[model samples]
Structures are given as C-alpha cells and as structure tokens.
Target chain A: MLNRYYRVQAGPEGYLPPAAASMGVMLPEKGEALVEGIIVSEEEAMQKIAEKIVNAKNPVFFPGPNILWAWNDSVLEKAYAVNDLVQSSGARVIPMPDYRPKYPMINPEVEINPNHPNLTIWHNHIDVCVFVGVHCHYANIALKIIRGGTDCYTIAICGEAGHEDAMISLRDVSIDTLRRLNDVIKSTGEGLK
Target chain B: MNKGLVKISPCFEDVMPQEYKELVEKGSYGQDYGVADLGSFKELIEEHPLCAGCGLALSMRLILASLPNPESTIIVGSTGCSALAFSQVALHNIHSLFGNQNAVATGLKRALKLRFPDEIKDVVVIAGDGATADIGLDMVMQSWFRRENITTIMLDNEAYANTGGQESGMTAEKAVLNMAPKGKNFPKVNLADVAQVAGCAYVATCNPAKSRVLEKAVKRAILAAREIGPTYVQIYAPCPTNYKLKPDEVLATVKNREKEGTYPTGEFISAKAQELFESLEGGSK
Candidate 1:
C-alpha cells in the first residue's frame, strides 16, 4: 500500500503501520469522531501521528494563521507548544508566505500556500506533512490537493472536527492537546535515539 | 484558455510545480463539479489570507467551485479583501485599480471576444461592496447599461472591512462603524434591484450561509451573462471582524438577518435569460 501511494523513498526503517488500515473498525456512528474516515481514539491518532513524524526522513510542519495569530496569551502558548512539537520531531516549519507576523516568533525555512501544499511538499521532498492552526475549509482544500497530487502523508491538527482527507487528524485540539502530542513525539524520538 | 495550454512539457514535468501538474490532470476545468465534490478534486483558489470564519472567503470558495468553465474564465478583481485571496487563485485574474474592476473587465471581455470569437471566454468581475456600490457605482452601472458580456459579483461584507471597518454604501441603516460613528443614516443600497432596473439579464441576491443556493445563483448568473447579457450576483458575506462577532458566528448572523427581513436572498431572470435557461435545461434533459 505504501509503495502504491508514495513515489519518494521512505525512511530506512520503512513505512510505519498504516494508521487507518491497522485500525479494524467501521465508520463511527457519529461522523465527527472519524479520523481518516474511520473511528479512532484521540490517543491512538496522536500516537500514529507521532510515529509517522518520528520515522519520516523529511518531515515538514505547515502552520497556518490560526496557529501563529495570537489574540491572547493562551493562543500564544499554543503556538509555543506547536514550535516545541516541531523541534522535538526535528521537522522544518513553513508558514503561509503571505502572513504578516503577529506574535510568537516562527523561523520558517520556506513559505507555503495553505491551499497548495503539494507544491511545497514536492519542492522540499517532504515525506510527512503536518498542518496545524489552519482554517477548516482551507485545510480541507490543501489536504485534498496534497492527497491527489503528492505522495506525502498528510496530518491535520484541527480545532474543530477532524479532516477525512488527512492520514491522521486530531480533532478539537487545545493547548493541552498540543503539549501532549509534543510530549509523545519527544518520548518517541528519545526512544529512537 | 485552451486546455492544452496548461499541459506540462514532458522534459519539464519533473521540475514544474506539483500544483500545475495536478491542476492539469485533476482540476475541475471542464469537469462537472460543484460544492458536493469539494474534497475529492483540486480546487482553483489556493490558500486564502482572510480571517477565520470569513463569510467572503467561504463565498469565494463556493463561487470559484461553481464556475461552469474554469479553464476559460478570466476573473477581474478590485481592491478589497477579495483581492487578497485573488492573488492565490490558479485562474488568470486581473486586479485592476480599486472601483475600476468593471471598466477593466469591459475592455478585457471585448478584447477576448475579438480574439476568441469561436471559444467561450468568461470574464467575471468580483469586487467588494465599497467598490461596486460606491466608488465604482457609475462604472458598474455603465457596464450593465451597455449590456456588456460579463458577470459582476459583489462580496458584500456591508462595511469597508479591509480599511479597519469603515462604513460603505452597502452598510445597513443605523449600523455603527468607523465612518458611521453614530449610525448609517441611509438603508443599504439594493444593488440587486439596481441591476434589474439597469437591464441585467439575470440578478440574484445570495449569502454564503446557503452554499447550494449560492452555487446555483452563481452558475445561472455566469451562464446567463455568457449568452444573454450582463448579470449580477450580490453576495451578503458578513464581515465577522467588523461586525464584532466571533468567527463562527458569521453564518448565524446571516441567517438572523434573513429571518429579520433585513438581508433577503432572491433572484430575477429577464425574459431572455429565462428562455435561455429553459432551452439549456431542455437540452440537458
């Protein structure tokens, strides 16, 4: 399945367990609970996301305005947690090119359009792509385009319901959710080390 | 506007942006796509820089998706929040001076008609209410009066949102804003009615809250303008930032306004446009 989807060579360790395929379950009774069109617990989704990031040869984090725009201190803390997650996972961060800086400094190696994720992924040779703090509609558009056009495994950390197009999407993410994901990635990275 | 024009050369396919490659292969250029097929295909507009829960962004997304022929469509935009998003759209868009979108579109459409007399080239003018109903009202009306072959769409946020939330001609009566400190003294300019009176073949008033309805209206307006005459679609995309409402509260505000008999949504088709739609429907059946 990985050979069928991915064009670029994956990490030396090979592709991690197929997150959606490994989960033996039908669609959730409530559609909102679906991650990658299947019902998966939030913890399980986070674990799968961490595994992909930890195992990816070239992982990139594309943070949208929602993550970087700090209207208050809580949002700023969430932004910092995102940065920590990127650092722990050793993933490069790319912000929307048109974004005017607001708060919580982000050092983006490159700029990407949230609507055209495939261009960035193809240019950067990213094997695993994560999107956080993006508006739901824009994220939906980007994830679909990435799935249709590229081989990168896409993850959407959404503030609302999870995205069906992403490989593993964490829904209703709060600051705590960000910290927990970061911790999980950190532990997984430490174990690998 | 030829579909073949977007084809990537085999030699440059590896280096061309993946987006261009996908657009040629999977985009809804000549395909039958609507809001229902959103997540399954490559959308035209790329990432937008509008505020979260912006009604204008949502409306633009729906409108772009509803275009009957995107490959041959040339969008004419003016200075506003819509212009910010226009830069990222994959289509050939012209961002002329503020309030001069109609004038530019008129020239572009005429020139395209002369060049591609055989092909269908859609020239769409999309601008904010300030540009449509105030600063460029005369030009917009002139285009309608001349029966130019173009579709004019208004992203009516009701206020000059990009300029820090000032009052526009489309602002509702008694609405407080930066310019209208106390309140707007006049009622919102009914651009739909004006378009009807000014000899538009098709006129529709819609909001982003009703996606399917807005989609049908956009399709009808664009299709009507192609054969009938100039058409207009007024979209009541409420500005969440200027309205001092939460981002998620935009749809609810639109629904509430509709219920209160304030911003109603309706459509008017001239006799010719109605006949054209009937003939097209008959052929499809």
Candidate 2:
C-alpha cells in the first residue's frame, strides 16, 4: 500500500527532496510537489480539505432524531439548496410542517350561530394561493375553498391538540398560491380585499 | 387618509390582563401532553416568526438558553426546521445557504478559535437529514474529519417531513418512511457509521422521548466542542403524521421505535451506550 502511494513518482518539479519532505512538501519554482514525478498543487490540497470537511460528521446539526416538519404546500427550493450545503457540516435535518391547516370546520352537531358565517379559504396546489402572508398549513383547505365545493370561507387555523386554542385561519402563503392556481375574487365585504 | 389618529393601545400587554400576559411565563404541557411545552413555545413563535414546526420549530427557546452564552453566539442553520430557529432572528444572527452549515460552522469555529479561543460563545447548528446525509454530507465529513471543534446534533426522524415527508437518507432500510411511495428501498446509510468513519471520535445517539438522555448528550457535545474538537450525536424524534400513528398513539409509537431499535437510542457504536446497541444493525443479513 505504501509502495503504491510512493510509486506515484515525483521527478524534477514533482520530486520531494528529504528537507522538503521533513517540511511537509517543499514546492519547486512551479509551486507544486515534485515527488515520484507527480506534482500536487496548493489548489488540489484545498479541494481535498473541502472534500474532507464535506464528509465529516459532528457539527451542531440537530438535537436528535427530529425533522423540520412543514404544514405542506411549499416550493422547498431553498430548503434543498441549504441541505446540499450543511450535511457536509455534520448535522442532520428534519421537518414537520404539514399536519393539516387549522381549518375552523366546527362540528355541525355543536349548536352555534349558523348565521355567523365562517370566513376562511382552503388551498392545496403546486403553488401558493390567496396571499403571500398566508401560512402554508392552510394550503390544502385553501385549495378546497377555491374549488367552490363548499360555502362559508375565511376561517382561522390554530395549533392543535391540547396546544393553544384560538381562531384565526389566515395562513400567510395562501394568497399567492390562490392567485396562481385559481381566479381571484373579491373577499368578504368586511373590507379585506 | 385622515392624519392617522387611529388610537393604538398604549401597551399591547395592557390590552390583555396581567394574568393573560403571564401565560408566557407559566409552565405548560410538553411532549407528554398532546401539545408542546408551550410556555416557551408562544414566546419563541412570537419572537421568531419564521419558526418551523412542532418541537424542532419551537425548541429554539430551550436551545438559545442552553447555549453557554447567547449574546456572543453566532447561530447557523442548514436545511431543516433548525434553519427557522435563527430565521426569526431579524438581527444579530446569520443564516447561511442550506447544506453549508458544517462549512459555515467550521468557518465560525476557526474564526472564533483564532479570535477568542480563550472565552468564546458557542456556534450552534440546526441541521436536517437530507442536509446531513446527502446535501451537506461532504461539508459535515470535512468538519469532523478535520476535527473542526463544533457541536452537532442530528435530528433523524427517518424521513423528510418538511418537504411533505420525502424519503431522506436517514430513513430506515426496507421500511416505508415517506408518505408518498417511492417504493420500498433498503440500505439506509447509517449516519453514525459515516460519522465514525469520517473521524468523529465522540459520538452519541439519543431519543427525544428520553429528554434526560438527550440533555446529557447535549452537555457532552457542548463539553467536547469546548475542548476544541467536534462531537456528533443522532437524535430520534417522532412524527405523528409520517409515522402513520394517531395523535394519542404518538408516545407509544415513539417508545416502540426506541425499543424496536429502528431509531437506535443510546451510543452509535463505542461512545457511551455501545453495549446497549452493539448488534444494532436492524438484522441487515
């Protein structure tokens, strides 16, 4: 194995003299390694180091066994780009976004003011709908609303299951997605365009 | 528009009574409950708007405080929910392009060691599986291989949940993790093995269900980083949606995952919990 490594040849500009070997590769006038008739350059060393770091593990990546979950309906171009860069830094990534938008679809069994119309939209498309500020969790339902399959749009989404309970369903990204995937209609008469 | 006499409230806190405002201070249920430990959850989301989901999205409150020093700290996030952790910080933080966290983290670490190796702050990175396994794998390998002195915690949920649960490199071999079927595949790359081979001497794996174990791992990683070296850990967190488990059944499923060794809680090979997971290769034979 060592012979294979040493047999690569460094001659003339590629040969490594004894003093140069002791000093960790003394370069010739060409600024390259002259060992076994083969030359190694500074740029090659940097690339090797870069490659090494790209494969190293143990940089503060994640706490453990967790992913960054999204609420669905995202382009994820930037996410993929970033992932391409960091895995080399030795951390893992996880996502948890789309567990379903907090749509305010109250159970019909519950007796509430039927006249109090729900004001929310459902969206599910390859693009963002409604507005840019709409949250992504609403993408699926927003898609549902734009299809006109149901009445009473405009509902709020809340964090689910014993978590904080509230009623404001305007996820930020639904608007642009809605615009892209469907036609834009005037919002409810409460002054929200 | 009339000269803007809209009469905004004096203190937003005043609109809500002290009791309601105190909600951010009081303790609340966490993983044990169907909800997160939302006392910090609300504060984090309120403070960091770009925050992502569930635990990873909102865990920054704990992570920020856990960092030995925050004021001097420069945070970097790769491609996962961890990226959102610092994203909300509109100031005093740096968010690098994805997959370069290991690289960025290395730069920060080297700059720090050169700058204030005496008394410096931590460089915490929130990375994801795809970022770690494929996209950023090279950078990660480089950092630990050089022993670049950083603390890395890998959150391995076995699938890519953020991008609608795509199959990541960490997904179990011959198991279905991605919701959309890419068909069954095998030979899930053992990140621990890769880390080990890449020269991560101090490595550990822990389950989020076991927070104490996780906390200890955090401490160990931090200490290792402080020693001017790199430390690696793989975390096994659970996902209610991707796991195909009901909301109520998440804990059991998480526990089951740990017991079944799909997530491999404990040390990866020779670190601390070796005896617990030595024959741990999921019977690939």
TM-score of chain B of each: 0.97, 0.70
**Candidate 1 at residue B37, lDDT?**
94
Q: If candidate 1 were superposed on the true structure by all CA atoms, what would the RMSD be?
A: 19.3
- Residue range A33-118, candidate 2, lDDT tens digits: 22222344423422332333333332111110011211122423322322433333333222111121112332222111111112
lDDT of 1 by residue, B112-220 (tens): 9999899999999999999999999989999999999999999999999988888998999999986668999888888899999999999999998899889889999
Candidate 2 runs further than 4 Å off: A1-193, B1-65, B89-93, B177-182, B268-285
Q: Residue B201: error of model 1 in Å?
A: 0.4
True contacts kept of each: 0.00, 0.00
lDDT per model, in order?
Answer: 0.79, 0.43
